[model samples]
Target: MTIEQEKFSGGVAVITGAGAGIGSGIARRAGEVGMTVVVTDISAERAEQVAEEIRGAGGKADAMTVDVSKPAELDRLANEVFEKYGSVRLLVNNAGIETIGYAWEIPVERWEATLNINIHGVIHGVRAFVPHMIKAGQEAWVANLASIGSFGIMPVQTAYMVTKHAVQSFSECLYLEMELAKLPIHVSSIIPGQVKTSIFDADAGKDEPTSTARHRQIMHDIMKAGGMDLAAASQVILEQVAQNKFWVSTQPEMTEALIEGRIAFLRDQAPPSLHESARQLLEA
Candidate 1:
């Protein structure tokens, strides 16, 4: 058996945003690896559809409606999961939304939603669940979704990019906290590079500035053309998680390149500039 199966088989995994995109892919992969997967999403129908797919395939799964933007909701979810399963072996804070617009042009509601879901969601997910995992005193894993955007700068995607940067920093600090406490809980920052997901769907950006439609479509096209397959990326992410890696990346080369660019920018105190591709996309 592979390390992933050896480590995660017969465990319970709780994943947020498992109705679609990377979250759903990881949920399916978890079920395939012999875990009982709890698939949570804001949309009850989407969550149940994924859960049914897993169950139909002879894997174990359950669906629940969860809005990760609320801390109280996450607390309730943690309590319910622990009560039902006795222990949770994996927790993935993977629910996030992408908002496309010039920072000033974005609506107040969109800005708040982006910040609450992308940043606070991950924070509260950790806060609400860690205590339970600690009390259980069993080895567990927590993976937070940090994007390649964490290491770079973007203009129109300011809201989403900032949240990713926060998640990356949060994960770094969380890893150290686990080490200091000598806990069996492992923390991983999942940096995905262009994974094929519905993050940039037109309907998802309805709340953003109307002028952002072109930019949003450009990004959606780019993702469709070049992003890695969702299932493949999920496999890579979970494998690294099973190995207890602190930095789990679907595309290591992309992560390395972004990190290198970030290092140079910091070392030289360079003014932020858009890449050629980004310029083309934004200007299109």
Candidate 2:
């Protein structure tokens, strides 16, 4: 019933990680408004399933597989969507991963893998697609997935926080830069608190992971403890989007943490303990 809800009708959207969870939820919601959707995921079958679901619901839909960290794959996916629909007015970069461990105990591969998928994936999508959106000369949207972790470090999930910080910074810069260029394309970033999605299983080793994986036993336990329904969270997010809200967030709890952390960072001197932790992790 919001203005944004009224406005999204008849648009064509490209959503990453659209096979399930938040991505599927966004794609389906986009469908409800009669938008042509291109569902993309690393799993081709799952992506196709999401697209088919939209089609089944009497909406325009298509599907593709993309490893978002790879520029070539992202470029191809963009071209395919544009070739069929003429424009990709909305882009949701929602693919990500997380691994949990004590800073010193974390595996370098796990850290790198998290960055590759969680951070660079968004980079690749932006690089391969956003310029074309700028040239399209329409009121477009770019939504990047971030997390509350970017506000402060979660004890065992250092890499996830780091990557989210990168994503948050990138999305913010993009939003400001686009505005400076007088573009109508809107930019938003979602920093979900604890949506009930398989995102918690991001580092679950080697399983198909329809939401059931965690790198660390304790972290997995913490995640398995549970959160809000993915559908419900997605709905909240969409409502925010309809308002041109850039920080589409579900958790009101972390606001203070965000405020305090920045204030402390601004007022404090570098602590030696911080360097020790970094050195221990890097020199291992």
For each candidate, the alpha-carbon lDDT, in order, equals: 0.95, 0.77
Per-residue lDDT tens digits for candidate 2, residues 1-284, read: 65545767778888898898889988988887777888899999989998998899998888888888677998898887767777777899998876665656556776667888899889888888887786777788889999877766554566678899899999999999988988887888898877766755544544222222233444445555766677777777777776788988877576456647656766785441333553464344
- lDDT, candidate 1, 1-284, per-residue tens: 98889999999999999999999999999999999999999999999999999999999999999999999999999999999998999999999999999989999999999999999999999999999999999999999999999999888889999999999999999999999999999999999999999999999998888887888898899899999999999999999999999889999999999999999999999989878877876776
> Where's the lowest-lDDT run of ten residues in candidate 1?
275-284
Q: Identify the leading candidate in terms of lDDT.
A: 1
TM-score between model 1 and native: 0.98
Clashes of each: 0, 2
Candidate 2: pairs in clash: 198-211, 201-213
Assess every candidate by TM-score: 0.98, 0.84
Alpha-carbon lDDT of model 1: 0.95
